[model samples]
Structures are given as C-alpha cells and as structure tokens.
Target chain A: MSDAATQPDSYPVTDRSRVKRLHERGRYDHAAVHAILDAAMVAHIAYVIDGQPFCTPTAFWREGTHLYWHGSAASRMLRAQKPGLPVCLTVTHLDSLVLARCGFNHSVDYRSAMCFGTAHIIEDLEAKARALDAMIDRFYPGRNAELRPSTAQEIKATMVVGMEIEEASAKIRSKGVGDEEEDYALPIYAARIPVTQVIGAPEPCPRLVDGVAFPEGLKGFTAGRRLDEVMVESHRTTFGVE
Target chain B: MSDAATQPDSYPVTDRSRVKRLHERGRYDHAAVHAILDAAMVAHIAYVIDGQPFCTPTAFWREGTHLYWHGSAASRMLRAQKPGLPVCLTVTHLDSLVLARCGFNHSVDYRSAMCFGTAHIIEDLEAKARALDAMIDRFYPGRNAELRPSTAQEIKATMVVGMEIEEASAKIRSKGVGDEEEDYALPIYAARIPVTQVIGAPEPCPRLVDGVAFPEGLKGFTAGRRLDEVMVESHRTTFGVE
Candidate 1:
C-alpha cells in the first residue's frame, strides 16, 4: 500500500536512467524514487571539474519534484554546481547481509536510487530562506519557529541549489538469501542478518538553560523505530502523501 | 586504542585530498581513514566516461594498504574502472542527527572518508580468487570452507579492482549539538539522536534444508552491537590488531 506501488506517474527511462544489468529490480515511479530519496539523509553527489570526477557526501532534502542541498557559499562543490552542470546524486540503504550457501550468491539486500540532473543555484533570497526553513523543519518539525530568525548575513553566506530530477530510477532487493538448490542441501547455515538504523535516546546538550524541556515535536520519538520508518512517517504526516 | 590515533605515517595532503572547509575535522592517519573505510559496507564510486560523471554504489573491502571492490565482468562500473582510471571512492556513516537550538547550527554527526587514486584492474586469476575469498570471509568469517568452490567460468566473469591509497582523508564530527550562545535559552529540544545500524534476527531462507544449524560464528553474534563495533571486532580477531 505504499505510494510507490500505487502512484500512476512514472519516470521515463532513458539510456542513463535505465538499469541494464539488473532490469528486474528497476523501478521508475515517483513512489519508488521519492521514497528512497526522502528516506535517505545523505546523498553522494558526483560532478566533474576539469575531467576529474569528485563525489561529495552532503545532507540533502527533497521538495516537490526537485532535490536540494546546501553548503557554504565558498565551497567548491556549491560553486561548481551553481552553473547548472550535469550531476548525479545517489542514495543507498543497506538492509542486510545475505549469507548464501556459496560465496558467489552472497550479497547485501539494499535500496538505492540514482538521480541525474543539472543543478541551478537558488538566487532569490526569499526562496532560499524558505528552503533553509524547510530543511530544518524536515528533520525537527516546528523547529524553525522555535529557533532564532536567520540573519540576512547568515543567509548570504550559504548556498542552496536545486535540481529538477530530469531522470531518476530506484532499485531494491529485500528478499531472503537465495542459494543454489544443490548447495541448500549442504550442512551449512544460510540466513540473512537484517540491518536497520536505530535512533537512540536523545542526549541533551550540557549548555542548555534551566526549565527548558523536550518539545512536543520530540515526545513521539522512540529509540527502537527504524530510521526510514521515522523519516517516512514524518514526511507523510507533514506533507499528506504528496 | 584505534590505529588511526596511533599511526605515524600520514597521507600527504595533496591539493585534491585537502579538506579546506572545516579543516580542523580532517584526519589523514591510517586509523582515521581505514576505520571509516572498514566500517562502511558500501562506497560510492565516482568516475567520468565521455565527460559525464557517474556515481555508483557498490560494496567495498579493505586489505593491507589498498581498497578493493568487485562486480560482474560486464557491468559498466567494473568495465569502465578496470583500465586504471582516476576515481574517487567515498564511504560515509550517518552517526546521528544533531538538532541544534538554532536552524543554522543543525547538522548530522558522521564519519566519512574520500580516497583519490587510480584503480588497477586485478588480472591475476589466483589473486582475484583470493580477493574474492577474502571478501566473503570478511563479511562472514569461517564460512568459506563450507561452501562450494567458485568455478573457472564464475571467476572469469568477475572483475576485481584495487586502488592504492595514494591520498585519503577522513572527517568526523561526534560531539553534542552546539548552538549559538543567545539561542541556548530558547524553549526547544536541542539534542542528538544517535543512529546505529542494528542487526536483527537471522531469517533463514525457505529453501533451507532440515537439520542444518547455525554456525558458531553466527551464534556468538548479538543484535544490539553497533555495526562498526562488530566489523572492527571481526577485523581485530581475524587479523590481530595492526
């Protein structure tokens, strides 16, 4: 019942977006693409400068049909990406290690997405400010209003860029370990160790002032919930299923 | 103590490897670089083909003084990477989400490493086989002997590549949230939600034959341990701490 399974609009597969090697795992719908993008907190961004490819890991947020990331105004990554250069952003979540009966069949179950587009710098101050607020509110709901208003000087020192997601695709593998039929009969253990990101109890900053308590936004937080579950749930409650 | 803290030889700070922004967080010793690289299960690889940058996610392993990854012989990533091309391999672990009292100070605690080098395609059959075996044993120790040996065709259809760590650096941020002095009095929850990968109960495949019990290596595994702890512990025991 996930949106990715029922959404009607699908991304058109291009030569670059196509999953040639494992076509069976490729997904081309908004549900699949957005779910993967929204659940991931970090995206490895790839861009070329003078024929040398550089992959920089940075925090990213998705708004509407575009993806955005922010960095220092003087950063080379931001400056190079501001000119609408071609870029590829990838996010991956390792679900588990699949230990098969044989070494060849061993693999990791994972969910990953690749988004290709040209990034354009957000120039309007108002829009940039809103983007920054949205980024904060995405992680900690109602947090922007709780914090101090950003100064104009602070905004000027940050760079926010957006990409239209020209072509995107997602691939997922979440099944039990598959071993050769013949090897399954061997006296060996074949099982998958499920891996998930767990959020621990919140550790308050030592410099906090007295009488200030955990806000309403953090009351529902639990330590045992999966990272993606918390993220996807927050997105749904905030955005109303897009 | 971790090797990164005690190692004497450091990676030369090249123009490409230098961390300009937040240089205080940069670490060039083996302990820092290898610890991040070893703990991360996946690495985002960046390379250029016809001037276009492609970032692909693949599992990676580290051995001695080099990092290694393998894929199908026909995969574009493997094929393109075999000719000793300049590449950037980045491994990142999202440690936690830092909810600062202010929006500007909000950040994610993470450990990341970026390696710059030319990838040499592993051609020797014996070496490649040993590398493959090492990869399997790295993830699931003491299981290689129980599985069937890889055939010649299977060996020929896999491409293994190694990159000497010419220049690499690790960046880490693990402290509690830090917000501006004025914002500390705000009635907001300013804390860190520690994130760690949890290993869940082993799920046996449907094709698992009867009477096969779990191996000794897996019996001693616990679900609550951190991914890095398990990986580092395994590495320590398998090849006594360097």
Candidate 2:
C-alpha cells in the first residue's frame, strides 16, 4: 500500500537514554529544548515508503506536551499519518558555521532536537477546528474569532496529525572552531562567528487596502520580540501553533 | 538485515524517473520556497529502521545539482543511506507568517524543497575523504586542506552517506495573508508581510590567533557589504538569485 492506501512504517529514533555521552544522546535540558523549539518556525518529518524513506517539512505549533502538524488532506504524509505512524520529528536552528582546524574536524555550531513518537490522526470535528484555530492564533491573534470558522467541506479536505512529547532529546553545539591542542599554536584562526535571526522592516502586501493601519497583531513580527511569546502560547493548546 | 549485514547495493533508489518534478520544483520560481530554505540553514532527513520511520536534521549545503549532508561516523542516516535507500529530503525556510482574515484561513508563507533519491555510500577511503573535504570546502574554501587527514581508526569508525538527487520539487507560499475575497474590503488588513535574514558584524573568535587577519572566506560573514553577497549567493544557489 502507498499514498492514501497507507504504507508500512519504517523509521525509528535511537534510544537516547541508553547512551552515555550526553551531548551525543541526551536532550540539552528543558530550557534548551524550549529555546530551540521556540526559535524554530518549521519542522521536517520523515517516513518510509516501499522500504525507502522520505522527509517532509511543514509549519507547526507546539502547545504544552503535544506538537501539531497539518497539511493538505491528500498529502502523501497525511495519508500515511492517518493511523498515527511512528514518526521522527526533528527541528534545527543553524546558529553559524563552526570552521574547525582540520578537514575531518570541520563542523557547524547549531541547535537541533530530535524526537520519536507515534502521530495519531485527529478526526474529531471540534478538535480539528481547534487545531486550525491554534494555528491561526499563533500567526495572528484575534483572527480565529475575527474570521469565519472553517466550512464543513474545507475541514473534511484538510488533515491534521498530532504527536506527543514521548521520547526526545535536544543537542546543541554553540562554540567556536575546535582544533587539536597542537593546532592551537598553528597559524590557524579559530573563532565563533555568531549568527542570529533578526526581523526586517515589514513589507505589507500590495493587495492590502488603503487607509488601513497595521493591526495590533502586526506588532508580533517586529524583530521577533513577541515570537517566543506567541510560540509558547501556541504550545499551550493541543493544536500547537497557528 | 541491518547495517552489519546490508551491502550498498541492497538499498537502491527506486525509480529515478519518479523525480520528474525536478524542473517544476526549482527553488527560484517559488518565492515561498526561496525565502524558507534561504532563511533556514538546517534540514531533516528520514529513513526506515526496523519497520519504523525516523527523521533527523544535520547541517546541510546546497549547490546547484546536489544537497550535501554529513555527520559523525556513527550517524544512523549514514548507515542507512550507505545502500542508497530511497530518501525524501526536505528544506524549509520560514518568513513572516500570515494572520489572515479568517481563523481557519490563517497560513504561513514559506519556501521548501523535497527530493527523492538513492544515496550511494562513498565507502572508498579516498572518495570518503574527498566528500568530507568537499563538505568543508562548501562553507570554507581553503580550510579543509589545512586540516589533518582522518586516522585509519577514525575513518573506520566514521560512516559517510551521500545522496544523489534523482527527482525533486520546491513548493512555496508567499506574498501576504490569504483571506476570503468577501472580507478583503473589511476593516481587516490582509496581505503578505516580508521577513528577512540579516547577518550581523562578525564576532571574531576570542581564541583567534594574533597576527593572522580574517581569512577571505569569512568575507561573506562580515558586516556591511558582505551581507548582500551572502543573500545573493543563497538566492543564486536556491533559485539563481541573479
């Protein structure tokens, strides 16, 4: 079976608790997990088809203990996820390139997290509606109540998948270049080139009508000050984020 | 069979022609994809494991024809990709989100790409060395040659997997908030809001040795003039920004 027919599942995350090297196997701790997840705006999900694997990425919202992922009802992933297949959900935020001393040693400084869990389909109309509202609320508040509810046909055409926290770990490397002790004295220059996400001046859509000022929600995207707040709030609901 | 038993030939990429969407999925035509992947520096890859699905994100590099991903020798993806497991790779970059006129109508504008391919393990010592070298060179031109070659023990312990693109597509959604046509003239402001990635002044590593000026490779990470180059380079690679 494939596509909407439902293919067999084939990917599993390594057991993090069994590993001794914390950096290699453990989640950085709660703060780090939240920080990394909050900093990210998207996620990549992977699954197998015919003994092969495929990864797909989409917008997501995290509220409390659950992560919500939604896409077209006809999406290959959506079809496969209907039974709540075991899925590996991962998120990464690249801080910068860690230019190390040696060829094999060259690495990047990044914040990434991986989790293993089974995603079950949310078939309830009320839950689906709430999930959609959560997504809307995260991207812009007041819109869920401000706008019309999803039509019955539209809801039926969309697919939403939900995954619990389950087993997960967040690992990070933020230091500068790492070279062997001997290479330290060499002519090499090693430093952490810091990188960050900064908001830019807003470019309103051309289709926006004249004389209408920016909404209070518009203040959210300014330099990402409110981004974390929004994301944290989004995670508060089962729908994840708007 | 597992990594210990499977040979490279066991994991052939099924149906290279299935990736026919490659041309239509070019990263440039889709502003959503361009913005998302450009803003995102990391991605997740998925594969099969004991009849389960798994996904993880590592640092990645994209040239014109290929997307390069590498990690430690013990990486599970490396072991799985050695046999050329059919894989779907995805990259997503998120810009300012759209808080549309309706709750269920809210959406995020993003840039994303997915490719189906078989990974051919670069097992030859020389080839493995070069692939690792090329990954390093992709970010820093002269640095790879500056480092020491991996010891035999290191090489043996390390696993390297390379995926050759067979088929791919880049999907995108950008501009502004998508709202119901009837609500367009209402008090609501519906339109696309732009988000940007800005490179700040390079903070040289504190350990950077004295007497050695910043390398030319670091030019792109520099403040001011170099920033534009970074964006242009990314655009060119993702969608031929020129």
Candidate 3:
C-alpha cells in the first residue's frame, strides 16, 4: 500500500518542501508553520487512491507537532488514510484583495500553510477522549466541563487520526501591490480591500432553557471583532504566533 | 500522461461522487455544484505527482462549468497538472460553529463543493486573455478597463490552466446541532456562533494619483454583509437560488 517514491520525509527546503515561485515568502520553521495551523479553523486534506486525488475540508486541531481530525467511524476517506499512508493538510486565510494599476500585478494578501506527513489512526479510547477534550477546549475555552460526556456508543462510532508533520512550510504575502514601473503613472484607482472573518452575536438555540445566560466563553463579545482574534482569545493562549 | 484509473468520469452519486457519511446532505445536480463553485473565491487544488498528493490553495473562477486558475509559468505544481492529469478542486465556507449539549454532536455548519476533473493547459492567447479579463472583471467589475492592459511579456510569463469538471458534488449542513435524545436535559449553553467574512474600508495606496475617487463598485457597501453575498454581487446575475 506504500511506494518509496510517494513516501514523505522531512528535509529542509531541498525536496518537495521548496518554494520555487516566490522563495522570499517561504518559511521553513516550526514556529511559522504552527502559527498558521493554530489560527486556522479548518483544513483542506488531500489523499490519493488509485492515482486519483481527493481534497476534503474538515476541522482540525494541533498539539505539539501532531495534527488530529475526527470523523464518523465509517468514513471512506478516513479509512483510506491509515498509518503509513501519505497525506497533505493545507490551511489558508485570504487576508485581502489587492487592486493594482496593471491587471497582471493584481493579487491577494494571504497566509497559507502546507504540511506533508503520514497518518496513524488513534484507537486508544483514553487518548482519543483526551484529544477530543483538548480540541473542544481549544475552540471554546472551559467548555468541556459544561458539556455532557460522550456516551460509549458515541465514542465507538468516532474515528480519530493523528498525523505527525514531517515536512511543512508557511507562505505569506502581506504587502501592497507591486505594479510595473510604467503603470504607476496611469490614472487608476489602486488600493487594498481588506478582508477578514467576523463573528456575529451569538444566537441561542430556540430550545434553550428559559434562564440560560450567555456562557462565559462569549463575554463582551461583539459583532465586529476579527474572527481570528476571537478564536485566539477563545482559549486565552497563543499557538503559532511569535 | 493519463491513466484509465486516473480519468475523472461523470456519474451521479453512484460511484466516486457519492457522499457516504452524511448521504442526505449531498447534491448531485449541476445546479448545486455550479452554485457552490460560483460562490467560492479560492479552491484547494489537489494533484498527484510520482504517487504523492499536493494540495495548493489558489484563486479560481468558474465559467460555464469550467474552472480556471492562472499562475507563474515556472510553477512546479502547474507543470505536473498538464492535460489529462486527474485533479480534485474543493471549495468550502464555514458558516457557523454549533455547540451541542453533547460533545459528539458539536459541529460546524458549512457549504463545500468537491470537483473531479482533468486539467488542460490554455495555450491559445485569445482564450487565455479572455479568461483573465473575465476573472479580473468578476472580482472587480468595471475596473479592468481603467487599468493598464497587460504587457505581452507579462502574459507570456503567466500560465493558465482549465479543468473541465467531470464529476462534482455539493454538501451543505446549514442548521443547528444534532444532540442525542438524552442530552437535551443538560444545563449546557448551546448556541450557534455565526461566522462571516467582512470587507473593511478600502485603503488607497499612499502613492495614488490625486483626485482618484472611490470606484463605483463599492458604493453603499456595509460591513456586516456576508462575504459570499459580496462576492456574488461583485459579478451580478444569479445561479441556483430560487
């Protein structure tokens, strides 16, 4: 089920991890890689079967150098990603759209992390539950204590996979446009259109109990705060940012 | 460069396109598939090289069931994704985070589209230029005419690839959580935290010419409007929605 040519091994920037297009924007350190992963809510996971590639979007969590994702036990995608199988997990954030004086120069400011690794299914009940709890607490701090514990049947039906990042790189483009020298003299409206994810006011479930107040997790919440900031503050701990 | 096993064949939910985990959420029709593709700004493109999968996030535009993306001519990823090579492109939007009474029931509301297809390099200069114009106009309507035309050198340095979608499906989960029957009585704070991408005030370049007024595209713009709606409105005319 494995091919020597397909296996992923961690090296600096010489092999598949190298950034050829814009080498200046590439970062090969763990700090840069971890920061992007921690700030992202979802990852686009790609795996191959019978030479056909499939990219699926799912929520993921990171602890140390390992990333974890859980899904239904019967999922075909998850089942295909067993231990020693190659996988690529990618996370991206579109920071803004840059309109330049020349069409060729128009671009976007974005942060993206690409990780290559091998998957190992987490079958131990205790370890699985611990990872689940940590994931919940990471997204909604102190939330695990308030929620009902997972039933035996629920645990039995869930499957979690751990991927140790073997080789990873972060690519970022945060500056303004780079227009051609001749185009800067033209009469064009060039600017940066800032884009960010925002969290709106919490809407309680219709079946919520009559006196259930907003939980401590959402205190002082407003509609305009950046989604990245809200997620970072959810656990009051930093992950990938320096 | 093409293999029979790697060829993307169009079929309705019977073979590879079927959504096995949550079958009820899958849509096999072109209307659903096109709607999701039209609404997304970026796509996670996955392709296999030497049996290894690489998922790269890039801006994509869809026109008449064909998806197009352009990049530097020297891109290694693009070189490997030549005509007849299998590819998968996925687009996702995170609508909200659902907090359920049971941890197992917690999930996010999302809209995602998975497309399977074969890639073909757009070598015709006229078609390439037209696609590029449609892309720029789609993102910033009526702004292309005002900008300086792309130089021949710039066009020659860029490579455009088109992927004809052979099989595609859209999966959406829009409602609240699905808690177990026994967990409703718990005193947990369950709610939906709405997530949206916001486009803030445009910041003009400090070197912008004097008297360059705000373009007509952003008139009456509000901050709270959903990013999907804004992107759809950027290129007027609707698809799929009743």
Q: Interface RMSD in Å per candidate, to 1 decimal? A: 1.3, 3.0, 1.0
CA-based DockQ, model 2: 0.44
Among all windows of 10 consecutive residues in model 1 chain B, the one with the lowest summed lDDT is B1-10
Q: What is the C-alpha lDDT profile of model 1 across B177-223, one tens digit per residue? A: 97877787776678888898878877887777798878876554566
- Can you give the lDDT of residue A54 in candidate 3? 93
Chain A TM-score compared with the true chain A, each model in order: 0.94, 0.80, 0.90
Q: Could you report the DockQ of all the candidates, in the order they appear?
A: 0.70, 0.44, 0.73
For candidate 3, write residues A1-242 as lDDT tens digits: 11222433322554677777897898777767777887777999989987889999988978777999989999888888865578999999998888898888999999999998998888899998888888888787777888888878888888888998877878999997778787777778998878898877878887786787777765634676777766656535423333
Regions more than 4 Å wrong, model 2: A1-25, A28-32, A209-211, A223-242, B1-41, B62-67, B145-157, B224-242
Per-candidate clashes come to: 2, 36, 1
List TM-scores for all candidates, in order. Answer: 0.94, 0.80, 0.92
The model with the greatest DockQ is: 3
Candidate 1 regions with alpha-carbon error over 4 angstroms: A1-8, B1-8
Chain A of candidate 3 gets a TM-score of 0.90
lDDT of 1 by residue, A1-242 (tens): 23333445776687777777767898988888999988877899999988888899999878767899998898888888876889999999999989888788889899999998998999999999999998877766666887878889889988998999878889999876887677877777788888888888878887777888887766545778788877776666555587
- For model 1 the local lDDT of residue A23 reads 74
